[model samples]
Target: MTQKITIDGKDYAVGKLSEEARNQVVNLRVCDQEIAHLKQRLAIAQTARAAYASGLRKALASAEVVEH
Candidate 1:
């Protein structure tokens, strides 16, 4: 079974992909890529948070030692 699909304003003839190709596109690769991308973003956010907390702690310690 073959079907025609339009993509980017161009007509493309797409035949029914094999079972493996269909599974890879629909099940495996898309979700895996999304999960990997999210994990990367989470690591960056956690690092920024740790840096901010460290800066805040240093400022607080300095303030406590200042005698007025």
Candidate 2:
């Protein structure tokens, strides 16, 4: 079975693509992978930030009680 890629609503066989076109496809795939990775990293960082904020709020509340 031939690998097909769609571009601008048109489908082309990967095996028929020119060398430069094939290289561009590879670059696009790499870029897509990196973008997905960065998005996952961003989600993890956001979750950590929220946890840290919650911890800080709890710590401050405890400190207030200790001082009182």
Query: Could you say which candidate leads in TM-score?
Result: 2
The CA root-mean-square deviation of candidate 2, after full C-alpha superposition on the true structure, stands at: 3.1
Candidate 1 lDDT over 1-68, as tens digits, reads 56655546975455655666555555655798899999999999999999999999988987857578
Worst 10 residues of 2 by lDDT: 59-68
Off by over 4 Å in 2: 65-68
- Candidate 2 TM-score, C-alpha based: 0.87
In model 2, pairs of residues that clash are: none
> Per-prediction TM-score, please?
0.57, 0.87
Model 1, stretches more than 4 Å misplaced?
Answer: 1-25, 65-68
**The CA-based lDDT of model 2 is what?**
0.97
| Clash counts for the predictions, in order | 0, 0
For candidate 1, the TM-score is: 0.57
